[model samples]
Structure formats: structure tokens, C-alpha cells
Target: MSKEAIVARIEKKPLSMTINGKKIGPIDVPVGMPMIDFLHHYLNLTGTHFGCGEGVCHACTVVEVKSDGSMVDTRTCIANAHSFDGKTIITIEGQAKTDASGNVTQLTPIQTAFIEKFSFQCGYCTSGFIAGATAFIDRLKREPVKRADLETAIEEALNDHICRCTGYVRYYEAVRDVALATPGCVIGQEDKR
Candidate 1:
């Protein structure tokens, strides 16, 4: 076989998904293209930071809403764009409500808490932290953790995420505050009543 015949051509596939509450794609994407590149190059949603690119830093995290409505933190740096086909994903930009003018009208509790607590320094990892924490909060709403387990729960939820600045305390504290403030996130409170 000639060298030209030995080299395989890159295949393109139609990719479509709902991102940040908007339906996007069915556009042709090269197979094996990372989701981060798809989000940045095709959709222009730059809020999902590309950190380690190896999927270890968690800075590329986005929330994938499952069919049952449960959310999971998904890493875009390593996952192929086609892997998200037909899925519902929420990036950091989607966490805030916007007006017709594209101005942010309201930030989700998790986002607000992160800002208030100064949970990030350079802010590169902030998006992933927000996405992970938001998913944790959503889970807590469905299945409240015992008050005694709140600390452990928070740690477990965010353990995989890495932040180079601000240590991990502020992020944990911010999520803790949000979970505690949100009604039904903790279970033991009812026993006290």
C-alpha cells in the first residue's frame, strides 16, 4: 500500500446538544475533537476554562444534566465533542440569569457565594468549582445530607477539583454556606424542631 493510502482521513460527524439552555449544533465536527475546543471554537462559550487539558485539573468542568434531571460534573478537556451529542449541559455562563440585553440579572446561589467568599484568586478554576458545587447542591436538594455529614459531603463533592490559589477552604466554605442556607439541603435540622 502507498503511504497516502495508509494515512486515514479524519471523519466528521454531526454533533448537537443543548448548552447553556440553548440548542446548538448538528454542525459537522471532526471526530475526537475535545469538547473544550468545540465549546470555544464553535460555540464561543469561553467560560469553561481549559486548565490541565488532561482532565485532571477540573477547570474544564461543566454540568451535564442527565435524563432523570440529575446533574454531574463533566470534564470537557478530555471528553470528545461528539460524546455530548443530544445531552443537556450547563457551563459557568449558564449559572446566571440574564436579561434581554444580555446583562446578568441574577447569579445562582453557588455563584454568589463563591464571589462573596472570595473562593478564587486567578479565577481560572472558578468555573469548574461553581459547576461541581452546583451539581452537589442540586443533589443535596433531592437527598438532603444529615447536618453532621454536611462537611464530609461538601469535601466529597469537590475533592476531585484542584485550585492553585486561595487554597480549598474558601471554596468549601462558600459551598457550605450555600448548602446550609438553602432549605432542605440538610436533614438533621428538622429533628431539632
Candidate 2:
């Protein structure tokens, strides 16, 4: 096929989604374009880092809040932009509250814990860590884990993320601290007994 014909065959679709509590698009996006590109190039929501481009590193993770109000971490590197149609997603940008002037007024406990614990070095993977940890914490709110299982749960939830800076200890520790501090994230000792 000729280059012109192939170029003409490229498909475009209208994409729309709720991102970070804000409605975005009805914008035309090329089919098969990665969600990461849509976020960075079209919307300029660059906090979702495109690390490793292949979805293995998971530095491009975002939280997709399902219709049932459960959140799942989604990797944007390989997922098509069209796949997120009408979905509600939260990027790293949405983790904190901002004042009317757009200045951040409060950080989510997970975010504050990550900072207080110094959970990252280069910070490239920090967004993914935050998204994953936040979702895990939210899940705990709905289904509290046994106190004894908290550590293993933390490890399981965050184990897939690859941090080149070797900040795993701090990251895991931060999440553990948040889980313990947040009421209902872990079952009470009395309940365990």
C-alpha cells in the first residue's frame, strides 16, 4: 500500500473521560496511541511518568475509579487512549487538594507519608508508587486486613513497581506506616484476637 493510503487509513476517535475529578476531552485521538501520550501531549498532565514505555516498570500508573467506587491502578504506557473512554481516572496530580487559586492546600496521607519517609530518590517512579499505595489503602478501608497480614499485603500491593533508585525500603515503610495510622486499614488487635 502507498504511504498516502496508509496515512489516510489511520483511525481517529473521540475520547472523553473524567480525570482528576475534571472532565476532559471529546478530543480526537489517533487509535492505538498510548494513554501516556494522550495525557502528556494532549492534556499536559505530565505527572504520569512514561518510564520504560513497555508497562513493566509501571512508572506510568494511574488510578481508575470503577463504577463500583473501587480504584484500580492502571498502566498507561501500553494501554490505548481509547480504552479509557468514559472512565474516571486519577493521575498523580489528583492525589492532593488544592485551594481555589490552584495552590495545594493538603496532601493525601499517603503522599505526606511518602515525603516524611523519604520514599523516593530520583522520584521518577514516585507517582506510580503513590497511585498503587493509595489504591491499596482505599481497598483496606472497605475490607480491613488482619494486623498480622498488613506487611505482606503492603508487599504484595507494591511489589510489581520497579524503582531504579532502590527506594523500596522507604516506600514500603511509608505505606506500612500509613496503613497502621489510618483507622480501619488494619483490623484492631481486639478483633484479631
Candidate 3:
């Protein structure tokens, strides 16, 4: 890659954020680059993967606020940086916990679930699946999800991602585990198959 040109100078603007539990800054960043590039190149938050630059792959998924109060997985690879100007964005880096005693702790329940289920092989697609699964679990938390609904949610969430390794069955299992672990959210109906 080339430095190209400093077409623009990023200002020291305020960007208040509370990632995980810590309040991250009010930092300055280039205004035009995509959020994924900024996160990887600038912030060094590389866990967010990129498969398709055209936004078809959920490999670059990150949680963001929708027009409504709910949160949805948005493709960071294609999302503009300035669009997140004031909103709180959560990347894979923001999903884990940090100890007050100065030690980084174990992975969150969602992360642990992925590992326990052996959700991925190459690991390229793991983070995005984690992000999407987090949202899916959150959605299930609010209501009683049926078997079909659980499958539907998993299908919709995983549809945008292309995993060349570890066929999607494991990913589905991860989501299923999270859903089943959450009370009242398990696939309740009989297997139609």
C-alpha cells in the first residue's frame, strides 16, 4: 500500500465511547476512510475481518445503532467513518472484559461459547460470527424464540458471511448454544425435518 496523499487532515475531535466497560476516547481520525480500515489501520483492532469489499460478507460485521433504539450488525468494511461520529460502536476488541487488577480476563460468554462449540477452523470468520451471535442472543433475550425463529435468526445473521472453512454448521451450533443457554430462548418446536 502507498501513503497516497494526505488528502485530508484528521482533527482532534471529541468521540466519547464506553467500550465494554471502560470509557474510550474522544479521539481524532481521518474523515473519509471506511470504519474497518480505520479500526484495523489506525486503532489496530484487527479482529473484525473482511471477505467481500462490497458488503456482501458479514465477515466485517460490527454492532451499530439502527434508526430505532435497537442494535444491528453493520458491515464495517463498507461503512463510512464519519457516520459513527457520535454513536457507540462495538468491535471484537470491545466485547471482552478487562480487570481492575490490570489483567485481561477470559472471553465473554459469547466468545467462550464459540470456542466451546469449535465454531471455526481458519478463524478468519470467527469474529464476525461472534458479533452477529451476540446480537442474535440479545434479540432472543427480549422474547420467547421458537425453533423456526431461532433457525431464521441464525440463517439471517449468518447469510451475509462466506466461510471457506468449517462449513456453517459449527457456526449455527454456536448460535444454538447461546440461544439454548439463554432461558426461554431455546428452539421450542419439534424438528420439522
Report every candidate's CA lDDT. 0.92, 0.93, 0.73
Candidates arranged by TM-score, highest first: 2, 1, 3
Error of model 3, residue 48, in angstroms = 1.2
What TM-score, computed on C-alpha atoms, does each candidate reach? 0.92, 0.93, 0.80
Model 2, range 1-193, lDDT digits (tens) per residue?
9999998899999999999999998999999999999999999899999999888998999999999999989999999999999999999998899988989999999999999999999999999999999899989999999888988899999999999989999999999888888898898644321
RMSD of 1: 3.5
Runs in model 2 lying further than 4 Å from the true structure:
1-9, 189-193
Best by lDDT: 2
Position 40, candidate 2: lDDT: 96
Better of 2 and 3 by lDDT: 2
What is the clash count for each candidate, in the order shown?
Answer: 0, 0, 1
Off by over 4 Å in 1: 1-9, 190-193
Q: Which candidate, 1 or 2, would have the higher TM-score against the true structure?
A: 2
Give the CA lDDT, 0 to 100, for residue 51 in model 2: 92
User: Residue 167 of model 1: what lDDT?
Assistant: 59
